[model samples]
Target: MKERKIPEPKPLFIERMNRLIPDTNDQKNYWKIVKTEPVNTIRVNTMKINSEELIKKLEDYKWKLIQPWKNYPEILIVEGKTPSEREREILINKNLAKLEPGELGRTLEHLLGYYYIQELSSMLPIMALNPKENEIFLDLCASPGSKTTQAGNVMKNTGTIIANEVSLGRMRILASNLERCGITNTIITRKDGRSFCRKIKEQKIYFDKILVDAPCSGEGTLRSSPKTFLMWNPKTIKALSRLQKELLKSAFMTLKIGGEIVYSTCTHAPEENEGVINFILNEFKDKIEILDFELPLKTRPGLTQWEGKEYDSRVKKTKRVYPQDNNTEGFFLAKFRRLG
Candidate 1:
C-alpha cells in the first residue's frame, strides 16, 4: 500500500488562525511550527512503572529521554531518528518503549502497557483533573483510553471512573487500552455524553470530579494530524460549539455540588474555548465558578474579546497553550467548580 500524502493546510483555516492571533511575528512562528512535524513524546505508565525505572530501562537501550516539565515529570521528550520498519519491530519485540516512524501504534511495550505514546499537550486536562484515590470521576468523552488510563494511574486504580465513548469502535479500543494498562476501577459505557444526566436520572449518580474533553475542530492538532485543515471551517466550529455546550451542561449536572470539572478542547477557536465557557458561565452563573490554575508551560489567557464580541471577563482565567508557546499543539483548558 502507498503511504498517505498529507494535504496542504487550507487558506481559510490559515486566515482565520492568523486573525485569531494578532501578533504577526508569532503568527508566522505558529505557521512554521504547525507545518513541520511534531516532536515524539510519551508518558510513563506509573501503574506499570515509575518514571525513574522507565528512564533507566530505556537508557539501557541507548534512548535519551528528557523530562518535558518539572511539574509534569512523567512526560518525557524522546530524541532519536525515525526507525525503519524492521528496526522498530526489533525494538518492540525487545519490549523497548521508543518512538516509531509516523508515530505508529504497534509496539511490545504498548502491548505490555509499560507506557503510553501521548502528545505532551494532550495530557494536560487529566493532570488538571488530579484524580485521587477513592474518588468517583467521569470522563465524558473518554476514548482510546489515553486520559482514562492516566486517570486510573492517578487514582492508583482505587477510584471508580465511568469511561464513556459514543462510538462502538472507539469504545472497543478504549477497553483494550484499559485492559492493557491493568486499569480495573473504570467502568466502560457507550452513550452520547450529552444524554448522561437524562439517561441516569433514576440512578441519581453524581461524580466527585468530571472531565468533558469535548470534540471540536481540532485546529491545534494541525502538526500531528494535518488533514484537520481539510475538514475545518467556521461552520464546523459553530456546529460543534452547540454540541460542546450540551456536553458541558450534562457534565455539570452530573457533578456533585462543589465538585470540579475540567473542560478542554484541542482547538484554538474562541467559540469552542472561551465562548463555550462563557455560555456556561452565563447559563449557570449562580451554580458554577471558574477556578484559576497554573501549568508549568507558558500559556495565554483565554480571549476576553474576539471578532468584536466580548466574553465573560472571568473566562480570562482559562488557559490557552499555543504551538509557539511550548512547541506543542494548541490546546485550551478551563477548570470549573460547582458552587451550589
Candidate 2:
C-alpha cells in the first residue's frame, strides 16, 4: 500500500488572503486548488415518492447511487454517462430505433415533475436549514429555485414557503423550476426581500425558518463557473457585504421567536460569510442564539481570531467547506435561532 500525499495550499494566494483576512492561518493546511467537475445531482421529490421507491425507479436505469449523508434520505450522488452516452443507452435499453433531439426533453417523468438538477454544494444550505413539514419558510432572494425547490422538497409540500426574488427574469426561472419539480406549496413573490420582510412584520406574521442565501462576490464559485472569478473585485465584495447585512437584519425581524434562520453564501470571502453573521449576532445579541449544526461530512469552523479583528465568538459555530476539501464549490453556512 502506498501513502497518498496531501495537497498543500498555494503560498502566494494564501498570503494575500491572510492580508485580507487575519485568520487565514486557521484554514492554511485545509485549503487547496482542486478540479471542479460539473455533476448532475437530483433531489428526490419525497412528496411524490419515498426514497426507497425513488431508488428502485432509478435502479431500473442502472444509475449508480452513492449515499453521501444521513438526514437526507432522498439525496443521492448519482453516476451516469454523459448526455450523448445516456442518449445511446436509452435507445438500446428501450428498443427505440433512434433518439429524438427532444426525447429527453419530452420525458414523462420530467414533464410530470420527478426531480431537479442541482449542484451538490448549492444544496447544502437548504439541507442545513432542515425545514419541517407544515412550517413557514421563506427563501429571501430565491431565484432559479434551486434552494427554494430543495426546501419545498424538504417540507414535503406540507409547509408554506414564500420564494422572493427581485428580478423578473429570474422569477420566471424560479416559477418554471418549481413547476418542473412539482412544488406547489410555495408562493412566488417579486419584491426586494428586505421590503417583503417589512410587510410581513407590519402584518404581524412570522416564519418558522428563513434562509438568507445572500448575494455575494461569488469568489467561492470560481471553479463552478469562471464568470464569478472574472467579475470579482475588492470593491464588489465590500458593496455586496453592505447589502447582505441589511438583508440579514430584515430576515431576523421576520422570524418568529424560537424560529431558526440559516445564513449562507457561495462566496469564500469572510466579509460575506463570517462578517455578515457576526454583524447579525452583535445587533441582535439578546434576541438570537447561534446553533451549531453538525455537518455530515468533516469541515472547518470559522476563524475564531482573524487578522487583529476579533470576530464575535459565535462565529466559531459557523461552517466552511473549501473546494479542495469537499470536491465541490466553496460554501459557508451558519444557523441561528431567535430567542424570546
Candidate that scores best on lDDT: 1
TM-scores for candidates 1 onward, in order: 0.91, 0.82
Error of 2 at 87 (Å): 14
Segments in model 1 whose C-alpha atoms lie over 4 Å from true places: 1-6, 81-107
Over the stretch 306-330, how does candidate 2's per-residue lDDT look in tens digits? 5466799879899988765666677
- The positional error of residue 88 in candidate 2, measured at the CA in angstroms, is 14
Worst 10 residues of 2 by lDDT: 1-10
> lDDT value for candidate 2?
0.76
Q: Give the true-structure RMSD of model 2.
A: 6.3
